[model samples]
Target: MPDWATFAGFAGVVLVLLLLLAHASKSAVSGGTPIRGGVDRPQPGSVDPAVAEVHASLTNRVRATGRGTDPTHATQPQLSTLALLANVAVSQGAFGLLLLAGGWFTEIPPSAFGVTAPVLSASTLGVGVVLGGVLYAANEVGASVGERLGIGADEGLREALAPDSPAGWAVLLFLVLPIIAGFEELLFRGVLIGVFAAGFGVSPWLLAVGSSLAFALGHGAQGPAGVVVTGVLGFVLAAAFVLTGSLFVVVVAHYLVNALEFVVHEGMDVDWG
Candidate 1:
């Protein structure tokens, strides 16, 4: 039998960790300018000679989106892209280990958490890619809607997290993003909603609501509008999880959404804001 008490304890711990992470993210955003190759661009209503000189050098090659930094107003030390990526890797790795421990203690099979052996069929690959494309399109629309509603949705966090070099992009997309997608889908969809609903004999849809809220809250770094839009996105992904019963599908789809966001916005400098 599943260890209900252990599961409850595990879930509580996960919730606390997620909230702490979210708060830390918000705090991180409140201070330092996004480190764009150590170049501190001019912020609105203020300019520093050093920053202007650096900004001037890059003006011809890269368009400044006027998002992250005001060197004169910066209240914290700049966090390097490498350090930020390392922190993400360590944190998500720790979360994955915690989930494994929880599953072991709770006597929950991997399959119960939707970690089934992935199918290698072309159709499965097509489904995940197509689903990911649709979700990315939806996400853009949601961001637009948030803008129209005067939500002041900020992409600064995304800008801050963006990698600087081609090698960095490879790591971010292939390594970091995959870890994020896998861990998030497994924790939010597989365990929180799937295992809990199945074990407690409750409605998955109801659990989806709860999980989506947590998912949204976990993205607090994105600002107010992001929380709302992400909540909706979480529900859609949850629904996909419940209907398909495949973690692979959601992980692939999630990775694609994130990867495409970085590629289109940061890489191509689309300035969709």
Candidate 2:
């Protein structure tokens, strides 16, 4: 177990890294803000209803009839990933600072981060995969139930996962999904749990429950049922972290849940646009 200073040093490095990444991402997206519908049109623009209808019809027809992009392959989504990336990085960086101020990184278990040989055993890999699969199934079932109860998912999350090309899916699987999972676990589990348990002398289960509530409430954008489902899942994840003392375990499960959601439910779709 590392004392507060050791943990703070590691967190400081993470803070600096995330801040740099966020700055770069924000700069990259400084141009081309996403606009939505006619509401997003430039100021001082006005149109007659009949002319607008005609233009709308033509645009829709073109979208429906167009086969594919030109060989030049000049196409892009209405939005960019940079904004999302920047926000995540900035938020995580801020969380790092909070952890330092609160001395939340005190007395971390070595197993928390899965410190081990460079090469993992096959059995270890297998166990991780199985754990991830189980969590993935639970998350999916929770999301489904939430949807049935009219608790819509976060809009930004939905748009991000909308079906796109294989390249897009690959980008998410390799780059975005793991980053999100790791960031969330680092904040909610690693930092928050440490803060409560070590800083406040909270027991493991109590810290897990308390931090899990915060985790779920943080997804306030996802609505009530989303809060409920996520809160439950968050508790389970926190409990697992406490029991196994493996941050890697929770990260893997979280990543698989997100990746599977996108690939299985939202990756492949008949082109409707």
Please tell me which predicted candidate would have the highest lDDT against the true structure: 1
- Which regions of candidate 1 fall more than 4 Å away from where they truly are? 30-78, 118-121
TM-score of each: 0.79, 0.60
lDDT of 2: 0.51
RMSD of 2: 11.3
Local distance difference test, each candidate:
0.67, 0.51
Tens-place lDDT digits, model 1, residues 1-273 = 788568867977986876775565454443334444445422211001111122222232223444234443222223345445555666776787798788888898777776667643565567678899998999888777767886645554456556777777877777777887877888889888778877778798998999999888776656667777778888988988888777777888888988888899889999666
Model 1 lowest lDDT segment of ten: 44-53
The TM-score measured for candidate 1 stands at 0.79
The lDDT, on a scale of 0 to 1, for candidate 1 is 0.67
